[model samples]
Target: MAKLGIPAAPPRGRRIQETITQLRQRILAGEWPVGSRIPTEPQLVEALGVGRNTVREAVRALAHAGVLECRQGSGTYVISTDELAPVVARRLTDDRMAEVIEVRRAFEVEAARLAARRRTPADLAALDDALAAREAAWRGGRVAEFVEADAALHTAVVAAAHNGMLAELYASIGAAMRRTVTQAMGGALTPDRHVDHARLVAAIRAGDPDLAAREAAAFLEPDPGA
Candidate 1:
């Protein structure tokens, strides 16, 4: 320690990180609407009272989080908030299981439609891999492992849609619901149920979203008392 010393260096990176977090929170809070242009780098520097590098770093961080899109010529803009919800709330809420089913219903319905239209040979292969993993889990009495594959199969449907926002939303919900679904199914996803998955793949191969959607919905329905 010096008897007389200069002030400490600013915590540039931490400040920038906090600024970015606040910006994302405001966007999710709807203070910044979807597709709206955020402040320019210079403007953010002024508004945040930070250095230019700080603002730029914050913007880059937000861009990487999928909340902001930065174009070369155009300024940054808010993308979507589907993935920005509180993960803790998702995990702790009792009603979330029902909410998951509802969201799954709407999302998978459209996902099936789009997947059937868009699924390629590679997508079919991914689906097959997930199903095979799930079948092996059932046979081995590994309920947790099977539930993960079930989640993956649903995620594969959204991924097959080739829509970034939908895929992100499905992934978030899948993470939140894995344990609940495993408990609900209770090690009872039988060979016949696995056959339903095979049929779903067939529907996608045939480019029939309606049938695929129906099969997906059937699998998600809550078991009695489950």
Candidate 2:
């Protein structure tokens, strides 16, 4: 078993690990930006000098890690550049309902405060439109429409903050946030709910950060003992 000046081949597992590391390095280095489609499987195989199986496994690992997302009838795309994206994705999948609601509350309250300080006329107009849609859905007894409008209003508030990172984070958990909104609404269309929404919008429009934060917290507060 002796061949002078010859190196031993790396183990299969080690080779896969190396491949994964290389791919991750490329992705994190901005060779692939978030939301951009990655190289096709064959291209990756050729470029990485790895077997198709190895390339597929590396891609799957990155996808499960939330750095990439595979769309049906389309190629894989980078979903996030953050190394923490996988952790956040896992937590969102595993966190309890109350925990999810708490996270959303924190983000929304801060977003409201920032929106009050940063919103422009266009932002205010969008918020007003969202509010109007919500009220219309409520009065018309359209439960699904009401839930959608409620979520849109909150999204508008966050967009008004003009913080790209915050907006991206909020968007990442959008589905969970929508579910939380629907649950919080509980199929009710009360006048008090409309009043609370109006007050929150007014606070933001007036550029009162403290009042806006308070109003947002109160608006999103969960029912006691729910």
RMSD of 2: 8.3
Model 1 C-alpha lDDT per residue in residues 100-128, reported as the tens digit of each score: 67677888888888999999889889888
Give me the displacement of residue 192 in model 2, in angstroms: 7.7
TM-score versus the correct structure, for each prediction: 0.58, 0.59
Residue 184, model 2: lDDT of: 61
Clashing pairs in 2: none
lDDT of 2 by residue, 97-206 (tens): 67777778898899999999999999999999989987887888766677767767887898899886776576556556656666666777665555448988999999
Best by TM-score: 2
lDDT against the true structure, each candidate: 0.70, 0.77
lDDT value, residue 217 of candidate 2: 91
Candidate 1 pairs with clashing backbones: none
